[model samples]
Target chain A: MGTRNKLIYLLAALGGLLVIRNLYVILLQFPDEAAQGAIYRIMFFHVPCWFICFTAFLAAGVASILYLWKRRMVFDNVAVSAVEIGVVFTATGLVTGSIWARVIWGIWWTWDPRLTWAFITLLVYLGYLMLRRAIDDPTERAKNSAVLCIFAFVSVVITYKAIDWWRTQHPGAVLSFRTGGGNIEPAWEMMLLWNFLALGLIAAAVLLIRLNQEQVRREVDGLRRRVHEL
Target chain B: MRFLRQAGTIAVKDLKAELRTKEAINASLSFALVILLLFSFAFDPTAEQTREISGGLLWLVFAFAGALILNRSFSREQANDCLDILVASPVSGAALFIGKAVANAILILAVEVVCLPVFGVFYNITWTKRPWWLLLVLVLATWGLTVIGTMFSALTVNLRLRELMLPVLVYPMMIPSLMAAMQLTTLLIAGEPVTGEDIVWLRLLIGFDIIFTALGIGLVETVLVN
Candidate 1:
């Protein structure tokens, strides 16, 4: 009945439909790889998860800057929402990747640059959350974490360049926007597209849910304060 | 010009205060010595082994000592509400930040200058043979560390538990500079001739220092305003 609830359901329905379509193409339509075989199938989910992870963190960084500049709580909520979701997607990417590596690279883990960068990024953001929990003052927590997001994101950029700066066996990027999604076969491309659409819808829904939750929690805090005074 | 003069005056003020008390230098040097002693006790690695890891051990000293030193950089201002006095002055936040950063870097550099040869004598590392290259790397890398440490020091000045938060907040940001410095020092310690590889690490160090110094100047005002 409410507008926010309707929006959530609408996004969820759209995501579900797109995901079904993605599975249709993945399991049935797309042809298998001549070299990697069934293991290559995981790339569909792996790439999209990482794509979302990067997008989410970058969004968090921008929101962090805006929060510092504008002194707005909205951006703080946006930042915390984006970073928490980003960490989940990054974990998804890491797990999916490790599985793919187990089947393909003959080991569950490697000190490859991309994997190391992902782990470092995860720790850095995890540190962000830790700092948030450690500080009790709401304003201080928001401001410090905003400055921290900027600092963490810059370090991640340095980590990204580690491949070129040193030697590592981690494969190069998967979705190369420079080459317009490099070398994916037509059917595979279609599956990837639908999967990205599905993940995008899911990200939007999660962000909405988080923002709504924060709003309600703030209201609850305000009501508690009023009750205490009475 | 007036702004820079103010910045210089602040740095001089810190230097004078540090000279009179001699508190920070004593603590930082003692901390560095403890780290050196700890490394030997923990492993007591052979000359060959020490050569391999001396770069890492040296940075551990820098990271920990830098943390100790950075807290003092702002702690002086916290007494008698002197920080409010400075912030309320017409001098820009950038000046306050750079002055503190410079003073912290100089103090830590003095600690490192003494600790470097002490480490050499203790670890039996002959990398001191290339004192020029070693000092270059040390100076650049320590500046990079202090810039971030100094800014974060101001940021955490008002926190209830800053000592706990400072290292957690500062170490990750030090990775690039630390990595590059480690590589360069490793090369020098390995007795490898200076070549294109060392040049790459040097460039990385300079680039990191420049970027962070600019960032500190840009972002420190926000931290100081509160």
Candidate 2:
């Protein structure tokens, strides 16, 4: 097979392995917590979803900043694709966390700082996409949205900090590094590390597909413009 | 110095036009009044009831009215392609943004002059409240609202869904400030006194205003370019 096909196969295989391993680790290997029981299983996927979401948004914000500085479409493409993926990850995190909340906290939703901040952040980016859809010109859309993405990222950071300090309905921080490996158990941390890597790889794989798709779309758009000129 | 002068000039220009047309304030105040009247009827709850929610109700009106003012603030430039001309000029786009934001805040505050006392009477907002503290919160919160609103307004002014997109773009940004404002106002109006918690909320509002104002001046150029 060609190199492109090889890459695709590699990504596909990586994705499959990630799914299988995650299923095995979460379902079979993960011990049922004495306190939370099977419900604690959701923590594996839930935490990773948030990690991916934050990374995706951070990537999008960085790409947006680069797009503004470089004035390149590629950065814009990466930014938009990352934002889309971020939205997906954020949504998954919110929904699954809420489910876990219901199962654990016995409530479907609460004004927990993290949950509220995440929800507000989700709306902010959704607003970004909505603004994107409203504009017709592509460059204007990219430039304006990039500006917005950068600013929105700042807002997100502030929201996270402000809400974290504000009323916190959700649980506290996961990392207590100041205490020297204090929060999660060592084995649990090991499991979390593996899941993070696997999910991160899958995110990268999906991101590659999205970038390629955007490249094709741009090419098609260019070709159409040329044909119309003819 | 030049930037400050340019921003001031733009602010003067907007205020002068507003003085002549009175379109923005007229529309904004009318909207606020109607909303206040409608809410008074809708909630027509007892005195304590009105006193309790008056803070939230007042801010809700201000937020929507602020949106209307923002839309009008930009739409004025949309006339005869004035926005294009202004943007094409060598003056600072950040100045333009700040000028418009300052002008909107002033006009909205003008609307508040008309809206607040009426709301006070209707909702019995006058209690053992500290009016000066309420005014301080109002001014700071409105600054945060206008700066952020002005930025988003610039983003959407040239778009097809300019009006529809304003709230969607700005409301999220406005939440922390607005909530803080509402809480402080609630405390003041409820005769709860300005406690440490309320002071913290005020600090948060001030921080939001300062950070966003800095952000607006920095990013306004990129927004206006394309």
Candidate 3:
């Protein structure tokens, strides 16, 4: 197998191990909370999913800027790949948040600022993918979607601020790293970090796989164009 | 100064072309009126509750109908290769973008001017107290909408599904501006003075306008380059 394939397998294996170990620590080792018990555990996944989502989106936005600045196909590939992963992580974040809400807030959804902005962010990036589909030329697709991707990050920033500004049903920060840790158990904070590391590894592996797929797809498209010219 | 002149000249050129046909204005005005009528039927427009939602209904009409006008901004230049000629001429892409955005803003505002009175009549609301504040909100919000709409118009002008693509992309970005505009309009229409707390929405409107206007001008050259 190639070096790329070896790297993928290695990352996936390491990620799998960390994920199972994190799950063990999360479910078995961790005790039930004083309030909200098991449902609150969803935060382990929920917070990290957003962490992954924002990280991926930040990567995509930076790559898009580089694409525009340098006129590079690799940057375009990175932007598209990162976006696809970002969208999946965003969906995961929303779902995990929703499940937590259903238990705690007594509804499947609410139009609170954080939830509303999350939904809007999802729609905007989905629009980015649709816009990509509507264009045929590769260079035009890269440039237009690059511009759109950069603008789309604005929604992400707004979503982050939504919780901060409104402080609605979504609880304000409790994690021990932000806003002076907000009086949460340090053990829980450690567990959240472990979960984040496990998840980040998995997301990084998926990103690599997607980038490789995008590279292969581009090669095939280039070859097809050559054949057409012949 | 030269840039502003170029932009103004392009804006004038577009306005002249649009004024000649009046197709977009006619369509958007009628569409706005129809939405107002339909909304009145959907909700008892005379109800006390209507005052709470009147701003939302009004801006919804502006946004949707104004989209009709925005869609035509660049596509009209496609006839007889006018877009090519415009790009090939001395006009810069940024000027072409601002020019088209300004013209679209003016056209959309005109439609709003016609719709506001009809909306007032239909919804049984009066704007006697703060018409100037309402107008400021209208101008700021309309500029925000047209800047994003016009930029996306250029982006999607040549696509196979231009009409469908433009709105999907534009509306999400329009949310901040629309929310600010809608809330300010509602407050003003209710005869309430603009308070310190409400000033934030106005700030949001201005910030959104500045951010998007700058982005539109900065990126239009990339979007419009063949």
Worst 10 residues of 2 chain B by lDDT: B120-129
Better of 2 and 3 by lDDT: 3
lDDT by residue (B1-226, candidate 1, tens digit) is: 9878989999999988998998888988998998888888788556577888778888889888878888888878988999999999998999989888888899989998888889888887776667788788889999999998898788778777778877777787777788788878877777775686568778889998998998889888887777
Would you list the clashing residue pairs of candidate 2?
none
- Taking the tens digit of each residue's C-alpha lDDT, what string does model 3 give over A76-193? 9999988988899999999999999999889989988788988999999999999999999999999999999988998999888776766577777777656686477888888778
Clashing pairs in 1: none
Winning model by lDDT? 3
Q: How big is the positional error of residue B42 in model 2, measured in Å on the Cα after superposition?
A: 4.5
Cα lDDT listed for each candidate: 0.83, 0.83, 0.89
lDDT of 3 by residue, B51-126 (tens): 8887898899999999999999999989899998888898899988988888899999999999988877777788
Return whichever of 1 and 3 wins on lDDT. 3
Model 2, stretches more than 4 Å misplaced?
A: A1-5, A178-180, B41-44
Q: For residues B1-226, what per-residue lDDT tens digits would candidate 2 score against the true structure?
A: 9988998899999999999988887888889988888886786655567776777888899998878888777778888989989999988888899888989899888887678888877776674468788788889989988998888888887887787888888998888788888888888887777877567887888988888899889888888775
TM-score of each: 0.92, 0.94, 0.98
For candidate 2, give the lDDT. Answer: 0.83
Candidate 1 CAPRI assessment class: medium
